[model samples]
Target: MKISILTSLLILLSLAAQTSPVLKIKFDDIESGNIFLINVQKELTDTLSINNGKVTYEAKIAAPTFFYLIVDGYNNTRPLELVLSSQLTEMKFESYKVVGENTVNEAYPNSPIFISDPNNNIAFFEFLSHWKSFYNTIQALSENDSEEQLEKRKNTYHTFLSTNKQIIENNSDQYVSAKMIDFLLNNNLLQFETLQTYYDLLSPKVKESYLGFKIGEKSGKAGQLQPGKPAPEIALVDIQGKKYSLQSLKGKNVILHFWSSSCAPCIKEAPDLLKLQQGNTENLVVINFSLDTDNSKWKKGIERAGIEEMINVCDLQGYNSVTAKSYDVTFIPVYYLIDANGNISLKGTLSQITEKIKEDMP
Candidate 1:
């Protein structure tokens, strides 16, 4: 009778362990610090304490989800992204720097080597690697619009698209495919139809994943703000608590400048934008809608850029702002030109928008 009771207790414990998802992470050189785990899908952050160079996280996950791990006191290191599952996943990392006298410096690998990943996180990292490679190649190319340079850029972009499509096709059954599709969609790399196609090719299990649902939602919202559609209303307050709305600025050609303080490209285009607004004050209104979460930083960015003359507004919700979602803004430095009739005339980069303005307003 005693043996049978003990066996029953052991089986119950095993069943309980199997039902819970666990993640165990070990750092080789780091001893103790607070690590923040950010759930990408839910936008929730949890602080986990590290004891003796290790930390363990346990949660009931519906599906494989993406998370960002930010190490405390590592100001220079970017947040590490990982895909986690509802199964036991173990990971080890060399937290300290390999070269230089400052071993604890900010320079670190983009991602850590996973000791054990039950949920195809390794493949997700490979997808990110490919994206980084393509981005670097494009960034290194000449910026001139010469025929040869333009052709090279076109070929490079097409090649990247093809490579990403192949990767998604090869791993259609994996959760990483959903992540890859999400990345492409967020970056505005794929068209609406192509995004739908890639999403359709995903396995049914992957399509039911958390990221897959998010991709479906994003795709549904895509192309809603096309050139001919009515521009969505944006109501928000500026840094000084001054309220502004797109409806109030009607009957004038409006330039909805979606940006953030952290985006370098946005800051770089501030001067040009300021000039454009100044030159066309009678017919043009440039609304600088900032996606900054911090109030102080938003004020400072505007002051530093010296665009105090233009109308500025922010809701301090960052990407979660309703204005951002209504416009389907996933990337930074996006510009939209709403004509006098309050219709979206064009949406593109600053240069493209500038050319359109010149052609239409002239």
Candidate 2:
């Protein structure tokens, strides 16, 4: 009877262990204060206060999740945005002063050397560390006239990229790998020709992640619709709530311009765009896709820019707008010129558009 009781107790403890996974955070020098764990998807914030420089939270983590560890410091500067993942069980770091909005000094006093969990999180930090080291080496050799130094720097960069590529390829199934790709893309560290190579290395499961899907969408659309390719269809509603499709403007030379009201370059090019429209009214049609969420802001930008003559459409979904995704419009103030046959003739900056138009028109 005692044996049966013991077996049942062991089973219950095992089940409980399987159900609850604890996230433990330790900051050696941090004062006893409040910290927050914010669910990136749900936007739910769970507050916990430090007790003797440590805190722990337990949850039933069935699947992986991305979270933000927000530390509001005593100095009253910007909050630290430390990204956390469900894969990590414990995190150890030291409180650092904010030097800039997105910068933190890791060399703060009493800060112990730390490393990410090797189970799932280390690849990202490894890539970042190597990249930063390579950058510093290049900077140190910038004024050095020695050919050997330049050659050594080149070899070091090549090796760094190769190692990171292998790391990404090895962890292709993890969401962290996809996040690393996003990091590289935002920093312009990954070359355009190499996008497809890294994308192909990703597992289908990782590709389905939010960041992975964006990378996949970009890779699928990159080098496509360059010249003579049929332009991808864009179906969206204008600010007036009327439906318009990219195919509808087939007969005219269509300029599909992607922009946002907040983009400085887009705003700066307003006069030049107006001039472009005025010069080619009969032969051209400029359709602007505004990746703006707020209807009021889109309306005000249109009014302020005096671009009433152009076809203005806004799905109001910002970066995730269907029209923007269809064109892979990652950067703003991008324009694509489609010929009369609904085929793309050029896709680039405003100046490139001007040059391409001049080259083709004459």
Candidate 3:
């Protein structure tokens, strides 16, 4: 009887150890709504129903992973980003308010107050706060062109970099270190060399994390793209499922525009792009390479922009698309001008591309 009881206790302990992590969220100001949890690594979204301003969610994550939480019908509120590990995590939102009198309502306090953070979320938030302070200071200094202000800005910038480097190094083993590196790189906040140094400081286990691998992959491929280098071959299907390739468009100057439907800047420049294409229809082929994953949105964006004349194509892989990786497309609205010889001639923003076209094509 004693042996049987001991065996049963062992089994129960094993089962408890294998249980998935749970996320508990409490919003004092919100009630009877749905909270969407987006798992960044898995690219999956789960809806958690709020009952009495509280909800509990279970996540099947083995390591520290990034998640975004957004309230339904709250388009104005930025998604709350947090890192979750294989442990119980809790968040609390004390206050919120609906803004604007329009049909669409915006919400405030997108970030949540941590009730219990077993992971490195607290550290990540601290880092974000520091970065934001530094960013605002630099922006304010930019408005003052005095020599003293300029020197102050330079010193402040270097100080920010040094402080961030120290923070990352101190938390090298934490998952938040990798998250900080990713945030800095994605926002173009840090120089490539500094980013590489920070990346190298990550612990072996953190380096093997999902975000870490993605950063390394992007950095490794960054040097492959430049002027005079052969443009990477792009073989992707258009909206109509017709296959297209850069090889097929040889002997013509190609403007490879990387964009996405959700990107406001890309949409804003649509009419200008259409005009450019219309004016130079003889020898120029403008290919709109979209990074949107949703098929309906991609088509709707094209229709709304009235740029059907341009070669609109998408692999529907978003940032994970092979073509985007080859071109080192970190952000959207990136324009690449490839010459008739199939070599990259220039790459820049829309205005710069326009200048290049006017100088070379005219």
Candidate 4:
């Protein structure tokens, strides 16, 4: 009797497991097509063909899972995104131009278009909208703005940062907090004290998650080489076996260019830097720091690119170079323009540096 009862219980449990929730996604006016769902975390792609403009899938998810809904043969363009297991998430796609578009276009029917669980990702979607609006506002600012205008823009950015921080704090337990925290930390927008407090407020589970760990890594590196901050000292040997230091380039406008031989963009921007240095020979100096472990490749690249006009140096440590760490160098081809007083005046792309030089130096 005991064995029979145990077997009956196992059968019931199996049935219960099979009855896990089904996430139904119905697309209206999806003409003769297959929609694919790309799992964000697992890197798995699953497909569902639209039958009478409806497609249903089983979602046995405990944690919030993100899926990119891409229409097949449309350059893998994601028209809709689903953050699952929040609520009864449903999406409706209509009037899509999917044919003959070679490039992956931004998906339309933009957000607050929630699917699955509403509570899980509503904050995240809202944050995205706020960030987008803020970005557009910044982009609209005039490039030839005066010091007062620049200060105003800076103040506006800080205001947005404060607002975003509050949003993250309010939704500390949600996945959106982890993402926002990571972005803020990496962008050098968050204060160290605030970061510590935010981390403390996060639940133990969130603090231990993958996204949380990434946020922790970025938070540890705040206030490294922010604009208007004094450029940090960097001591490294040039390719020609000569030592170079940041202090040595004082009393001249310096470009602290961090790059690598393998970086295509870095190599491509070599000519532009050459032109900038040649054009402003009286006041400018480009200190090119190569983050290359292979000495031979570094030498060859420099010679081939004809970038020997500037001061080039490498410690042969690649990404682990102490100099790179001091400046918080994550991406190569990063340009930090320093004024005669050794304060970082600008930090951005080659074009941005050129624009700044024209505006300020000229």
Candidate 5:
């Protein structure tokens, strides 16, 4: 979809000095769309006029040459094959679905292949309408909201970004997915830590969440994770006063979605979750973890919300919930997506939670 808010900071640091190496690139016009080569350390540079859709260039780069490009509206890793003797690099484009003689076995089988033949390529931009709609809503909402309204706005926007992050985490083999995560994290309007936890869980991209980290006392930060981490053990109480641990729910796709009567935002999300639960979402085990402090009120609120028929529990500690502490739960109305393999996939909103369910369902 787009770079996650968590990875944008890393991208910015990697590009700060660009002393990595000197690489000159030129464009060719022998193809159907506009194209150029770029290094991750910097934006695209040295674009040349292409004749008939092809351009050639003489450039110097240290041994491994890798480049990416956005031609028209689609993004791709333009295979950079170095002709050492000629000091020229050849950039080739392929449709995601095109398979070559040497193509590696991958999950994205129908992913694009670089064919000048239009019949062989599917326009990648068409897949992004859902995202564009979400972003447009965030933009419009932001323009009219006041300071207090921003708190409410932040949660919804956070959830939206987390949904895209889940996609990247769910499909780690797709390298471009990480790029999208990076772009989202860099946006100035979003919270850094909320972005990072979602970013860190995907693939082996990086184990660090640089933006949300704190060197001092670390209680209550949404994204501050201990480095080189395993899943934090979380403990919650069932109605019978029996304790349940987050670690115990391994080998299943778990949804640790939080809601509370004290929180107006949390109360508003319950019905949507009820709808998600009814969908029989595949491989998803939703745990409706309540953050309400008063036990009597908590029981009544569930009946009122109509989520009484699902797997629900509470820590009664409210924000001090034991399992919530382990998972670093600062905000109510937030949800965690744990993949079937037990790795954390996402942490965000009910809508985002629903998106992950719809996406991973068979």
Candidate 6:
């Protein structure tokens, strides 16, 4: 009986994996298909809201979609409903409020469009188009991957980000588009590349905002760092009472990794990193920064992931670290590999290029 029940459970799990999810949200004035957070009491789960009433998700969305949503962000308050028919799948979004109101109030800057809804349109659709393309590319790379699938994902993501960079003029808004562009270069280019006239296009205020800024101070001007520039430095306290300087490791190769207890990917990558470290102790030094402000969670993550020997470090400032600001890091489980000379050697998805490091370092 026990063996049979275990087998049955496995079968059920497999079936769940194969199923595409359909959701019904009984909220009004929210017809958008933009993904959002689902609140069961106070905690959050993966959910998408209808930006316009009649829309279909058809696939899963990025996790940051949920973060922005939990903070009551992403989609503006618009009415939404589900439309299902026997023969086809489709969506329809309608406008709400007056014409001036039709455009998102300048207050609702993060609001998505109601598709054909007028009055709120900007000339920035090119940026929007590329961002959606990049996000979808990332969404497709979810754990189900064979060798062929992996190649296709990386190539597709690289090309999408590369082509899309042209549409982004400068660091004007430093929102989602800017984040996407940085992710692309850090992951694909390994360093920021300059396009002609990019600096000229940006005003002096945008370029000089970081001179005396605090760690968490954000503006509309975050972009990739220039060549030979020192990586962003930080003063952080570890599990011990000792404080450390991020810039002190000027003459060494440093692997700046960010993680938290809540992330499964962060957990999975820990062992791989330890093994990598043991093998490359001569050139590789890891400075892991945790986003978890909760010390219990931070300690639990370190214990559970078995990274005790790793120079596990954090400022306990969560998102307000000077390094995070300098690099504009928006997500966890990311790392920046700086060369011995203090220039950014590699950036972007760490797992994507682990083998490259293994080959070079070994």
Give the CA lDDT, 0 to 100, for residue 317 in model 6.
Answer: 67
> Residue 361 in candidate 6 has what lDDT?
65
Q: Which ranges of candidate 3 are over 4 A from the true structure? A: 1-21, 74-77, 97-111, 144-149, 221-325, 329-362
Ranking by lDDT: 3, 1, 2, 4, 5, 6
**Candidate 1, superposed: residue stretches over 4 Å from native:** 1-21, 75-77, 95-110, 221-324, 327-362
Model 2: which ten-residue window has the lowest total lDDT?
A: 103-112
In each prediction, how many residue pairs overlap at the backbone (N, C-alpha, C within less than 3 A)?
Answer: 0, 0, 0, 5, 36, 20
**Shift of residue 107 alpha carbon in model 4, Å:** 10
- Backbone clashes in model 4, listed as residue pairs: 86-117, 87-116, 87-117, 89-115, 89-116
Q: Put down candidate 1 lDDT per residue, 1-362, tens digits, no spaces.
A: 35698899999898765545368988888889888999998999989999999999978786788888787766324666677878878878875443333432222353666777787677767777777777777666656746687667768877988887888888888888888888777675765446667878889898788888766655443346767789888777765677766677778999989887756568888999998988898999888999889988998889878888778898888878898889877767778899888898987677878899999989
> What lDDT tens digits, residue by residue, belong to model 4 across residues 267-339?
8789988999999999998888888899899988798668985788888887688887877665567788888
- TM-score, per-candidate, Cα-based: 0.56, 0.52, 0.56, 0.54, 0.39, 0.43
Cα displacement (angstroms), candidate 3, residue 150, comes to: 4.0
Question: Least lDDT summed over 10 consecutive residues: which range in candidate 3?
Answer: 100-109
Quality of model 4 by C-alpha lDDT:
0.69
What are the lDDT scores of the predictions, listed in order? 0.77, 0.70, 0.78, 0.69, 0.52, 0.51
Which consecutive 10 residues in model 1 have the weakest lDDT in total? Answer: 98-107
Tens digit per residue, CA lDDT, model 3, 1-362: 25698899999888766756479988887888987889988899988899999898875577888888777876334666778887889888787554333522222334568878877587777777777777778778878568798778878878887888888888888888888888877774554445557778989888888888876654442344567789899887766677777788889999999887766568889999999999999989888998889989998889877887678998888878998878876766778899988988777677878898899889
Ranking by TM-score: 1, 3, 4, 2, 6, 5
Model 6 lDDT tens row, 286-324: 877887888888888899899988888766667676767
In candidate 6 the C-alpha lDDT for residue 194 amounts to: 33
Error of 5 at 216 (Å): 15
Task: Report the CA-based lDDT of candidate 6 relative to the real structure.
Answer: 0.51
